[model samples]
Target: MCGRVALASRDAVKACAGVDRELTSPTPLERDGEWARAGGRNASPGCAIAAVRIAAVEADDDGASARLARATVGDRRACAIEDVVWGVRFDSRRGGNFERSFNARVEGLLGGDESTFAAKLAKTVNGRCVVYVDGFYEWREEGPKGAKTRVKQPYMVRRADGKPLALASVLTPEKARSDAVDDFPRREAAVITMPSAGGELAWLHDRQPLFLWNDRDFDEWLFGDWARMARERRAKDVKGLLQWHPVTTKINHAAYDGEDASAPVKRAVEKDAGSVAALFAAATKKRKVDDETAVQID
Candidate 1:
């Protein structure tokens, strides 16, 4: 589930967006120092970070086109990159009391089930967006079953060609009561994830972030009919566009930041191959016995 991400700098975001003018809003800069310390490290949920999106702009004769913009949430306008909160919060009336809404499943979005959390956002034209990230982290577990313990072997997933990945995302404004005063909406965003059924990195996890690798994909993702687009293509089918490798475990600590945090590292094996094989064999034998006991009870 893409719980942690590394953001490109403001300049890198602009480069990806292909715009020269400053796309980030100035309001976030006026905040306290803590707020300013939001981006460019281990960006977890609730942290302020940079994202790229296309906002509808009015043209001559009331026509509009989707123009790329750096997006953040707290600003009055949705045109510039601002320091918005990461998770999308639904209205209390909607019965969405989720502790975290940072990753929206692609299946939930395109399942055509109106009851799903992402259904409404997926059908909306302006709800679509592309989040720019240098890379993201995922954990791989080791050891055997039952007695096995999961160790987070952090891995950095990035584009194979070294370009930044434009991750698919959805956005929404903070829910407020209809009669409430001073209830300005704070915009929030969430990354979308797809299943990793048959990919090389599937061993790391069963899910990966949905991303747009090139300009054509980016345009269709941000400006096309998202519901139809999602139905026609699955993100897992495009898994070849990304590459994943083991990285330092320092990323496990949210506060840890340095070049080494994302640098590729060799996996250090604590147990020899023989010991690992033995552990697996023992675990398999115990599992077979347990299954036989369960069948007899049934």
Candidate 2:
């Protein structure tokens, strides 16, 4: 299960998510610690996480046409991002506690017979969104089931090409809770997952996040129909871009946010560190230049 995620900065996330600007973030990133400097190095469920989704702004025919015609960005150019809550309510049995789900299965979205909330949500543009993160944490259980000697080794999975991963997700149709998140009450969303394949990915978990790779992928995910798309597992194509390595188990505690917390404790993937290091350097430089640019896009 993917319990924790890490992100760079607001600007860096926007650049990677390819959005205009953050629409609403009621709670400021803390003034100090890793949450301030590096965003959340260890973000978990039931917290504020950045998500790019269709904004509440309704465009008329002209703006809608222009949005459809927008190249690369497509409809997402008009989309807005917010600090959305990270968990979705999957069940509400009488007298039972609500079940919060951090991950939703892609199979449910593809299922013709599924009447689950997540499956139904997959059919609407409003329900579609993406959570782009620096990386996420997964623990590999190494031993027999129920064995006392079993060890859980954690690994950080990020793009080998040094780009943030745009995880396919489905947002609940409406805000399911009355409680506020970051002072702005919001709907919940869960990252969609598919069967893991390609190299050692299955070693970590049988299910991996279904990530969108490029402009076309993002465009289709945000606007296209689910039933009309090919059913041969589209998410598998993005697996080659992923790489992972063991990190400090301190990440087990979601509040332990920092660069060092997510850093690889070992040199497992040859491309992992080199690409991530370069990406951080480039993100810093690009953001600096972007800050000074005279053209105001947003």
Candidate 3:
């Protein structure tokens, strides 16, 4: 459901993850300042990838200690800020392509069909990670379903307090082998998604990314046994955790990157609305559902 996301600054990501000073930036960012700058804005797979902070136990002079490091979606090495590919590659030996593995369903990861390749990998390897993003984009379909005249209105979802959101994700080595000769093996990551049964943002889509906004939540997701943890926390409510506002349609075009690409634009229907609170209230009350389903945390 999370097709596009906007990342925070490099320093912000490091601060959020509490990265150690000894850790260094990835090679790509070290050689190119522009690439690092672009990471602050809306990032699409292949063109730009968000930095992920990972924590692991390593053997050192002190025996075993937990350390914080960085890795992109598909980096094969450890303790380095590796630039991994965005989409999860399918194993070539299986004769399938890496087309739709970018987003992993929360149900699948939390004890679904284990016969699939992704489910098997998720169960075997604890590839837990925190994806730092300023916000994300979604679309709401207008008009009747399956109608030819249906139009999708773009919306930008972000914290109501305007802080960075730490999204929980799962990573895996690139499934498909690349022909290009690269020094490191490619890797890919998928944002874990849950059913958006109830929320202000439910109007936009039926699924939303699992968010770990605080330190305690992040620690549980990153280090704890998430499958068990998710079951225990399944009753928690996530409504009003985020706010969604209609944005310019320019975000639909991947090539379009204007100053207002991610900015909230006045909705044509509510152009004369006097205040933002009124607009948000209207959206919240538009489709009142009493039986709001609880969000499952994983």
Per-candidate local distance difference test: 0.63, 0.69, 0.57
- Top-lDDT structure, candidate number: 2
Candidate 2, residue 92: lDDT: 77
Assess every candidate by TM-score: 0.70, 0.73, 0.68
Q: Per-candidate RMSD vs. true structure?
A: 11.3, 16.5, 13.9
Tens-digit lDDT string for candidate 2 (1-298):
5768886556766887667666775345553321232247787676667788766434434455334534324755568777666778655786765677888887777777568767776766667788778888898765457766655667888889888888888886556454443354367788988887654587778888877787766767776544444255554576568888888766666567766987878533334457789999999999988987846655
Tens digit of per-residue lDDT, candidate 1, span 138-232:
88765455645555678888888777777778876444545322322255678888777676567788887776666656656765555666555
lDDT of 2 at 186: 66
lDDT tens digits, residues 61-155, model 3? 22122223222222223322334445565546455633546677777766678875546545433355556677888876654577666555678
Clashing pairs in 2: none
Q: Which pairs of residues clash in candidate 3, taking residues 3 or more apart in a chain or in different chains?
A: 74-84, 74-187, 74-188, 89-175
Give stretches of model 1 more than 4 Å off. Answer: 21-23, 26-39, 57-83, 90-98, 144-150, 174-185, 270-298
Worst 10 residues of 1 by lDDT: 67-76
Residue 86 of model 2, lDDT score: 75
Candidate 3 runs further than 4 Å off: 21-40, 51-82, 91-100, 124-126, 143-150, 174-185, 232-236, 268-298
Which candidate's TM-score is highest?
Answer: 2
